[model samples]
Target: MTYDFQDRVFLITGAASGIGRATALKLSSLGASLALCDINSTSLVTTTSLCTGSHFTHSFDIASSSECTHFIKDTISLYGKIDGIFNCAGINPTSIPLEDTTDEYWDMMVNTNLKGTYNITRAAIPFLKSGSSFVNVSSICGLHPFPTFAIYCATKYAITGFSKSMALELGPKGIRVNVLAPGFIDTPTNSGVIAGEEGVKSLEAKVSLGRLGSAEECADVVAFLFSDGARYMNGSVVEVNGGTAES
Candidate 1:
């Protein structure tokens, strides 16, 4: 099916950076209005400014339940409906032994990665018009094992589970829920590795495609996932890591 997103309203979290930023730009270029939320107002404003029309921007912590409530309210107050939602805001701050993972770190990662996705989706459920789409951003770590990333991986895995259940729950309303699992996408956060010569070598070898991925590449998939093109795709997990996931 043709993916035409013209005049659609797309709500995206973590819109300030990386795949989220790229997807927001891509969607806006396709004639979609946007509602971007991020903890970083500085970059968040830049994202909203790039959108097609009177796009809205809200600076709120994804980890906070109350803030999510406010952000969703502001979204509908600014735009009557939410046609698509991308839960792109997340973090990876904890990297320790299972025992060393502090209560604070564990909570932070869990709240941001898991609860953040939940809070946003919960808040957006009402305003999501029928036939709308929700794409949750999960990582390949959720699919594969990684050293010192136990909690992070657990959270991403939870996304897949939660998304599937949500798809079934929202199916009657014609709302679709799916997961986007990306691998080694080169972004500012990972620039240290992907941009460096040695790190690049290591990353390229790990990918079955013998290369790293780009934010735009990931964004392209997201654009389709949010469009009518994905009308038949619900409760699916799409991995855009250039065969790395398959390997």
Candidate 2:
């Protein structure tokens, strides 16, 4: 379907790289105005340069409630309104067994991944109008298991649950909430996964498509979720894991 985002304004966290950057470019090409944010200011600027028409960029900690409020206010001040939001800012630190995980490490992951998503969503909710959609970035691990990635999996699972609940609460208010669960996407964020040729093959083998997916590929789905085409879709979890999700 042909997607057009003319005059629409979207707020995207984690726009510095990977699927977030790809989605910004995709939406911009479709004629949307963007408010992009990330903790990495340097890379966020690069993403802005790659996009087309009207856009703004911010570097902030999504984990901070005040920072999220500030960014949302700035977006409203510039665009006057928000049409949608993409909650993609997150982190995947070194994976270790649950027993080996420390309290500090747990707080870091929970704050950035789960609480960060919460911060932005809460801040932006009041600004969203009817038909606004929320496309939250989860992971295959959110739906499945990764032995040593307890904290990562926990945060992702929380996102899925949170998004679904938001959909139920916001649907009557004309807002749609959905989840994007990607698996082994070939982005700089996941460079370590496909580090060696052998490693690539091994990882790819787990996917029915027999390859790692691309950030751009995942971006396509994000665009659809935000488009008029998906007006009826709400509280749905869409997986872009190349068939890795259980049947």
Candidate 3:
């Protein structure tokens, strides 16, 4: 099904790569204007070059509330208003047990994965008028526990909770909020997990689909959540994990 976003403006964090880049391209194909940001300036430009619609790119760390505020402000200045937001900026955690997890590692995950989502959403609230939608990128780890991914799971679980609460708070204003929990997707971050024969089988064994998902698959769901087609979908946690986990 085609979701029309013609002329609408969207603000996407982490647009340099992975799901963020895929979502930006999907929206662009649907005729949306975009305001994209990421810490990697080179990759951010590369993403822009692949787009077919009007877009503005910025480089900043979403963990900094001030930088997020500034990026939102600049986006509004450029597009006049924001119709949707994709909070996709995040960091992957190391496979360290909780006992071995240092304060620095914990802080980094919380700041980027949890706090970064909060920072961007909080800053964009004022610009997001009635009918605006938000799609936060969580993970299957948010819904189910995984060994050695304690900190990452914690942040994702927090995101699901946060998005649900925002959905409730923003519902009266006609704004919608939802979270997407993706399973093993083939992205740069997870390349190691699907590298060798043993690695691929090890990861695939956990998925009912017997293979990893694609960033574009997740992007398609984001487009739906942001589109009027999902007008009634608020406070919903949608999983795009190829049946890796069921609720």
Instruction: Show pairs that collide, candidate 2.
Output: none
Question: What is the TM-score of candidate 3?
Answer: 0.96
TM-score of each: 0.93, 0.96, 0.96
The runs of at least 3 residues in candidate 2 whose Cα sits more than 4 Å from the true structure, single-residue gaps closed, are: 191-194, 245-247
Instruction: Write the candidate numbers in order of decreasing TM-score.
Output: 3, 2, 1
**Candidate 1 segments exceeding 4 Å error:** 1-3, 191-195, 245-247
lDDT of each: 0.85, 0.89, 0.89
Residue pairs with colliding backbones in model 1 are: none
Q: How big is the positional error of residue 102 in model 2, measured in Å on the Cα after superposition?
A: 1.9
lDDT string, candidate 3, 1-247, tens digits: 7787887999899999999999999999999999999999999999999998658998988899999999999989988999999999998767788999899998889998999899998999987889899999888888988898899999999999999999999999999999998888888887445366687677778789999888999999999999888999999999987777533
The segments of candidate 3 whose C-alpha lies over 4 angstroms from its true place after superposition are 191-195, 245-247
